[model samples]
Target: MSFDQLASELQVRKAASLYRGRKVLQSPQQPEVVVDGKAYLAFCSNDYLGLANHPAIVSAFKQAADEYGVGGGASSLVSGHSFHHHALEEELAAFTGRPRALLFSNGYMANLGTVNALLGKQDAVFQDRLNHASLLDAGLLSGARFQRYLHNDVDSLTQRLSKTQARRSLVVTDGVFSMDGDIADLPAICDVANHHKAWVMVDDAHGIGCLGKTGAGCAEHFGLSEQQLPILMGTLGKAFGTSGAFVAGSDVLIETLIQHARTYIYTTSMPPAVAAATRVSLKLVQTEQWRREQLTSLIQRFRRGCEQLGLSLMDSPTPIQPIMIGNADKAMAMSAALRDKGLFITAIRPPTVPHGSARLRVTLSASHTEVQVDRLLDALDQVK
Candidate 1:
């Protein structure tokens, strides 16, 4: 096939102000970073607890690399499942208060593997309209009867569940809506699912390591038991300052995924070094309550500043605070203006979000100081 159609499609995207570009980070993931050789106060990282470069995690990774080398070298089902991986799985199972946990290469794969492993042509999968792309794609690719309900609307979910006659029904949702930064009403959702005799799964990728008294995530925060929320998926990269993902659930669920999930069965496991480092990161996530406190304090400060400036903000209590800009061009312009002022916040546009709802996604971290947040507010004020 000729490349003419692809070339024209690229041009169309650029013309619509929906084009995306990447900036090279010359430094580590932190508040102050050198991107493409320019220093900027960045607020777009998912390192919520600010442990990406923590000394203890670094040391553990180094030690594990020396012992296990750099790669898994094979799929887990073959020879890649190392001791570090096994230990982390057990730790995660206990952390989430589930009977067992299975590790995946990443959050995308985790969602794909879990959903597909549990559903088929005779099954039904219900997802939130605003779930992460992976979850949506998983539901579509599962060959199940897939339906999307209104975002976090229990009545909508109940109505759909009541009508499905599949052999099995799974209701999936994000513990925290990534872009909007609002939490899922898990309790209400669980109640509704139970009423319909359906299973509930929560992808808490952005909720863990920054939520709950023990940083166990939305499940812990909402006090949902393993039976209440049967399937739980969480990522380590976001707040744990490491890479990979895990699904914690009943023993049967983990075994089912291990036996049937192609994404898990076919892919090489995550490096042992990362698993080792995550063990350390997980400890930090649990023992360090100050990180969550700092995040809460910073979020309040930023929201108060945005209110005073009269900027349209979303109803979010998490680190992600988006300033709503209805036009894509204006949102891009505002992002550029902030960059010019030495602040780096990305403007999220469709099809990542709905059309006419483009906005600047501002993520906070414990590493960010109060002065740095004020500087961001000042830059936003100027741009506005």
Candidate 2:
């Protein structure tokens, strides 16, 4: 096809109900926010712990700014790493019960860097079919024998594992699926990986700082040991209510990444302010257990209310709830309708989700109120 033909194809995407657009947020991360100059009740952020706009985190970030200036100014290998980054890594290691931790610019970088750095060509990488795009992309970039198992199916992973007799095999999965809002069976996956003599990697990007006591993440929530579930990746931008991501594991793992993870070695570290703010967020996630309690109660209330409304909500105990709408048009329409009623939930469509499984990904936060959930349900009732 010619260049003009390729341009035409792009236009067809917009015509075919598949193109996506972003809304500009003009206010802080909160239940009620100003998006594109309009006020709405937002159910779209990953800020489950609601520390994104917390006064303490804000103050800490500002104080760090006063001390450290703006950017890292260079890569860590060349003088970018700071005391704030160092402290955040230590706190992350303790939080996740790991010997050490290393931070990346984002969850995408952490997953890609870790997966690519660990196993390479001729090795085997088994991933959940619905694992994040970052993991899938990492597997491709690593030149590994990438095989996707059925989503959340440990047996499928084992079956694929049985097929591969490579020198290194890593089974990777998302602890909490970003779009589906479903939890992966980590215990079963870890057991299968162990039985097969393979390594397990959990990308608890949305699970950490949201589920477990002390907000340690899915492994802690399931009571799995660090030995049982090594190679854990957590994102600070989500429930941690800050920016960047980290890999938590033994000293060897962190050292290996420090030496070989291209993403971390090459990119400038996250701003010191982010690390400083994350320290504040971590303390709150540890001591302020009431936030978790409130979140749990809200999740239960939302699930029950959705059930009573006969809405098809995913079986998610966490605050990430998905209402499967099945078609892109319907999903987009649902989101638009809800937005019209002053609710700001976004519709997720392919390729963010599977074909024919478009959905409204409704996320909750500790800042959300029962009245807000009830109001969202009311909008759902009218839209449905």
Q: What lDDT does each candidate get?
A: 0.96, 0.91
- Evaluated at residue 307, the lDDT of candidate 2 is 92
RMSD for each model, in Å, please? 0.6, 1.2
List pairs with backbone clashes in candidate 2.
none
Which candidate should be chosen as best, given lDDT against the real structure? 1
TM-score against truth, every candidate: 0.99, 0.98
Per-residue alpha-carbon lDDT of candidate 2 for residues 236-350, written as tens digits (9 for 90 to 100): 9988888999999999988999999999999998999999999999999999999999999999999998999999988888889999899999998888999999999998888
- lDDT per residue for candidate 1 within 271-341, as digits (tens), equals 99999999999999999999999999999999999999999999999999999998999999999999999
Quote the lDDT for 101 in model 1.
Answer: 95
Q: In model 1, which regions exceed 4 Å deviation?
A: none
Estimate the lDDT of model 2.
Answer: 0.91
State each candidate's clash count: 0, 0
Candidate with the greatest TM-score versus the true structure: 1
Candidate 2: C-alpha RMSD to true structure equals 1.2
Global lDDT for candidate 1? 0.96
